[model samples]
Target: MSKSELDEIINRSLELRKKYHELELTHHGSHWSVEEDALAFLTDAGLVGRNIMSQQERWPKAHSASELEHKIGESIWWLIVLADRSGMDVKAALENFLSKTEKLLDQ
Candidate 1:
């Protein structure tokens, strides 16, 4: 995809998440506590990993496939927002991480 398309996707993702937060407030009547949200996302990541593993099995059904995809997408959104909040460039962070991993493997 073009850079502009990627940017649009990111922007839309952020907007959708903001709406989700609003809905949560409307129903749950409270903002997600930071610690709770972190723990919940971590738990979700673990579940996604399990879903991926199941899909790798010799015989697997597409159970909750869309939900799994949505969760993974949402997890990415969470990471992007977290990085932004922390004043870090997500692209730069990924590049630095990959560079370090490559150097380490070459050692």
Candidate 2:
């Protein structure tokens, strides 16, 4: 995907995150802490791993393709949210990471 497309996705995720925080505040009187967000992301990440294992037939519990796809998308959304909560621009961070990895591999 183009950089603009990726940035758009990140922006949308951030927008949704703001709405979610509003809900959290209404229901619980505060937004989740960054650590809580990290934990939630980790939980989804674990589900993604489980889904992959199921796809490989290594896991006893079976997960549908849709479930795996949803989890993967959710994990990515969490990454964007995490980056924002940590006061970083997700797009810049992603570009920096990719560039550094490419340069290192080229060496």
Candidate 3:
């Protein structure tokens, strides 16, 4: 898909997330500055990776595949939120990441 196409989707997803979690965010004082939000995002990212290991180890008592999926989405949302908080363009960042990875792989 085109960069703008992905951007449109990210925009809508962010809007919907804010609408759905507005009250929860306000209750938890989640309007953190860029650095704080980025750190929080990193924590969520860690959960995503931890959940992957849990799944591999068949440790579903606490972490299931569903939890893994949820954490993955949450991690992605964290990236979007952190980028937005920093006034960075999520689409551009994604494109740059893909380019860098492709180059590294000699694609």
Candidate 4:
């Protein structure tokens, strides 16, 4: 995808996240630290993982391919949110990671 596409996705995710936090505070009586958000992200990841395993086994309630794709996107949203909160430019960080891994593989 293009940078614009990535930017759109990240921007939307941040917007929705802000709304979600407000809902949590107003309706759920929630006051979550960054650490708590991280843990919840992990839980979402686990759900995605379980769906993958279940699909591999052809079991009931397994995520359809589209659902699985959406779940992966959701996990990425969490990563972006966490990275941005930590004052990192996640797109640049991803590019840096790719550069390092590519060089290591070429060595």
Candidate 5:
């Protein structure tokens, strides 16, 4: 995807996260802490892994493809939200990681 497209996705993800934060405040009296957010992301990540295992017949319980797709998307969204919560520029972090990994592998 283009840089602009990625930026737009990041912007929208944060915007939606802000809305969720507000909802949490309204319902629970406070937004989730960073650790809480990380745990939530981990929960979804585990579900993604479980879904993959099910597809491989390693997991006893099965989840539909659509369910797995939704979890995958949610996992990515959670990562974006988590980065923002941690005061990170997700795009820059990703670029740096890719550049460093590529250079390391090339060496």
Candidate 6:
């Protein structure tokens, strides 16, 4: 997807949260809470662990491959929103980290 499409997805998620609040009368009633965020991370970690277990089992395929991708995408979206809430620019932070890593590797 293009940058514009990604932006639209982010905007749509924001709108969905707004609608959720309208119906629930509470902030994050239908959105991600800290516990939910931790659970998401744990879920993704479990997927990764399962993938490792599959490798150990000598399986030729991964279980929940598509779901794993979706989870990863969701994690990224959550990170982006969290960064925005924390007043940080995700793109800038990524660029800075990459640059710093390159410099450290060169030393």
Top lDDT: which candidate number? 2
Ranking by TM-score: 5, 2, 4, 3, 1, 6
Which digits, one per residue and each the tens of the lDDT, describe model 2 over residues 15-94?
Answer: 99999999999999999999999999999999999999999999999769999999999999999999999999988898
Q: Give one digit per residue, the lDDT tens place, for model 4 in 1-107.
A: 98899999999988988988998899879956789779988998997887898779856774588888888888999999898888999999999999999999999
How many backbone collisions does model 6 have?
Answer: 0
Q: What is the C-alpha lDDT profile of model 3 across 6-58, one tens digit per residue? A: 77768876796577467657777565456765787788888888888887784
Instruction: Choose 1 or 3, whichever is better by lDDT.
Output: 3
Per-prediction CA RMSD (Å): 3.0, 1.1, 3.2, 1.9, 1.0, 4.3
Candidate 2 segments whose C-alpha is farther than 4 A from its true place = none
Error of 4 at 12 (Å): 0.6
Q: For each candidate, what TM-score against the reference?
A: 0.70, 0.92, 0.71, 0.87, 0.94, 0.59
Which residue pairs in model 5 clash with each other?
none
Candidate 1 C-alpha error for residue 85, in Å: 3.4
Between prediction 2 and prediction 5, which has the larger TM-score? Answer: 5
Instruction: Give the per-residue lDDT of model 5 (tens digit) for 1-107.
Output: 99999999999999998999999999999999999999999999999999999988988986589989999999999999998989999998899999999999999
Error of 6 at 74 (Å): 1.2
Report the Cα lDDT for residue 35, model 3: 76
Residues 57-105, candidate 1, lDDT per residue (tens digit)? 6236565778779879878877766665567877688779999999999
Instruction: Check candidate 4 and list the clashing pairs.
Output: none
lDDT of 6 at 100: 100
- Which residue runs does candidate 4 get wrong by more than 4 Å? 28-31, 58-63
C-alpha local distance difference test of each model: 0.74, 0.95, 0.76, 0.87, 0.93, 0.66
